[model samples]
Target: MDFEYLLQLILNGLFVGSFYGLVALGYSMVYGIIKLLNFAHGDIYMLGAFSGYTLLTIGAGVIGGQASIAVLVVIMLIAMVLTGTVGLILERVAYRPLRGAPRLSVLITAVGASFALEYGIAVSFGPNPRVYPVRLGNEAFTIFGARLTYAQLAMMLIAVALMIGLDQAVRRTRSGRAMRAISQDPKACLLMGINVDSVITRTFFIGSALAGAAGVMSGAYYGKIDFLMGFIIGLKAFTAAVIGGIGNLRGAVLGAIVLGLLESFGTAWLGSEWRDVFAFGFLILFLTVRPTGLLGERVTERV
Candidate 1:
């Protein structure tokens, strides 16, 4: 590929990867805390985009065309908070009661939750895709002959900031330390007086919040939102979480960027239609070679 084309592909990969990483954070965090795969995660992401769109439309109407950019930011914050709350409710209603049930049962529950959220959204929002208003400007910046829009840059920045903030929280705060403890040994942590349930719930909140933010960002950048938007991206994000190491937060982010780059290059070299195949091909290769993932710790097989 030409240098300019290479640069452009890299930029696109980073832009898309950031959102993948953001969504994957939820997967990684939930798995770390409870070891249950929240299959409805992608649906939650789709819901977030709808929530953002709704809030933005309402803001636009209430504030009129002359509203300042700050007003939009406030609306987005509200949307994120609302979406995060929904995520918490999902965990409570759909998953919590089944804790420690057969893995197969939980998996079925996850699938059911996924379908419920998707169809529920379809019923409520209709099957049609909605367009997100152009709240962010369309200024392009050139770097190394690669052009990037302001919205892309903003999405990247926000994703990075959230990741960094989460890193600090997990590594520094007392609540974060408790969360880590529970991840390492939920039974032991519960014995030690750490509220295991609360920690797990909080993990979901944080992770889902990140996914919600990504939803809004994706909607703004792509100018479209639909019930199925999360399906492919959610699968990709899960692949990213597994590739990086499901329980490792930083690994999730790193894996997402790598997957994004691989997909971008694959699409450029092969064809867009082969993107999903290429992704799954890599996933299978990694599973065969290193099932624990790139950064996942090796666990001793129990008898």
Candidate 2:
């Protein structure tokens, strides 16, 4: 491939990786606190995208229309809040009661939840895909011979900002300390007067909010949203979290970029149909070589 094509692939990888990373955060956070896969996370992501679309429709007073940046911002924020709230509710209703249940039961419940969410969305929004209006004008500029779009840039910026903020929150804020306490030892956190349940809920809020933001960005960038938009992306994001070291925040981001770049180059070479094959192949290879992941810490479970 030419240098320009390589650059373009790299840019594409970064843009796509950002979205993967955002979704992965939800998986990682849930895993860290609860050790449950929350298989319905993908469905939660789908809900976020649809929520964003709905918000845009209402905000513009039309199905889709050009809106000012401020208006779009409000719509996006509302969508995120609504989606995040839904996530909290999902955890409480679907997962919370099964907290200490068998892993298989939780997994099954997650699968059921996923199907219910997807179908519910379909029934409400119709089975057809909907186009998202370009709140940000569609414009492309070449950087170092690589074509880059404003939507892609905005997606990257939002993803990076959220990632950085999440990192800082975990490392610095009081809530972060509470979260870390819960992740490390929920029983101890409770003994120490920390609200373990509240921390977990907040974690869900942040993670789902990130996913919601990603939904808005994805819809805007791809110019489309559908009931199943989150399935493939959610699965890939799980791969990213596993590859980067599940429960490790930074590892999730790193894994996402690596996976995205690999998929981008793979699509360029092998064809788009083989992208998932390449990603899963990479995941298997990585697991075989380093099951703990690049940045994942070794932990011993006490029986």
Candidate 3:
């Protein structure tokens, strides 16, 4: 095996893994706060892609040219806001009502919500893949004999920046403190006059916004938008979250990057068809052995 090829695979893995990390962050955050496994979260990402597609198409009609980076950024932000609002609405309309309900019932509702988002988009956009109006052209440069595209570089950088910003927000900000506190004890937080519901809504918004940004970036990078795109990535992101420790933010990122690298190497060894199998197989192994995850701390719940 060629060393250069191996290096290339590693680079590609990191690039894709960054996206998994972003999506997993949402899963981890929601789970950490409410212990809810939001099946619709992935579809929210698909919505963001469609949102970006719609905005860019409109922008193209007005400008009569490929959207500038600035316009693209604006489109991404708009998509994030739109998706974030959708997440907030989902919490209020669906999850909020079922808060104290059995976990299984809530899980079922999440599945229903996921299906609703999926078919709703299908009905609106038609059951066909839509090409993105703005494509980040494949302009390549070499780094240490590994070929890298300008678009991939930008996506990686943006993803890293967002992850760093999120880390800081969770660590340093008042809202972050509230999130942590609520995660620890919602009843205690409420007793202290903290609005638990509001904080949860905001958490959903922020997490969904991150997923939205990821979707827009993905659409630009891949140049196609489809309603079902998020389904597989959602599973992978969930796996990443589990591998990194479900409720740990940094753990999700670490798991995603590791999963990406494992997939890359696995594909190189076995073939592309075995990639998912390899990932899921690893997930099973991890569950059987180290279920707490690489960075996950074992929490004892009071009976």
Against the true structure, whose lDDT is highest?
3
Between which residue pairs do clashes occur in model 2?
none
lDDT per residue (tens digit) for residues 138-196 in model 2: 68999989998766776688789889999999999999888877777888888899878
lDDT of 3 at 201: 99
Give candidates' CA RMSD values in order.
1.9, 1.8, 1.2
Please list the residue runs of candidate 2 whose C-alpha ends up more than 4 Å from where it truly belongs after superposition. 62-64, 68-70
Encode model 3's per-residue lDDT on 53-115: one tens digit a residue: 998887787855565666777888999999999999999999999988888999999999999
What is the number of residue pairs that collide in model 1?
0
On the 0 to 100 scale, the lDDT of residue 198 in model 3 is: 98
Which ranges in model 1 have alpha carbons more than 4 Å from their true place? 63-72, 299-303
| Cand. 1 TM to true fold | 0.94
Which prediction has more favorable TM-score, 2 or 3? 3
lDDT of 3: 0.91
Which is superior by lDDT, 1 or 3? Answer: 3
Root-mean-square deviation of candidate 2? 1.8
Q: Rate residue 293 of model 2 by lDDT.
A: 78
Q: What is the C-alpha lDDT of each candidate?
A: 0.83, 0.84, 0.91
Flag clash pairs in model 1: none
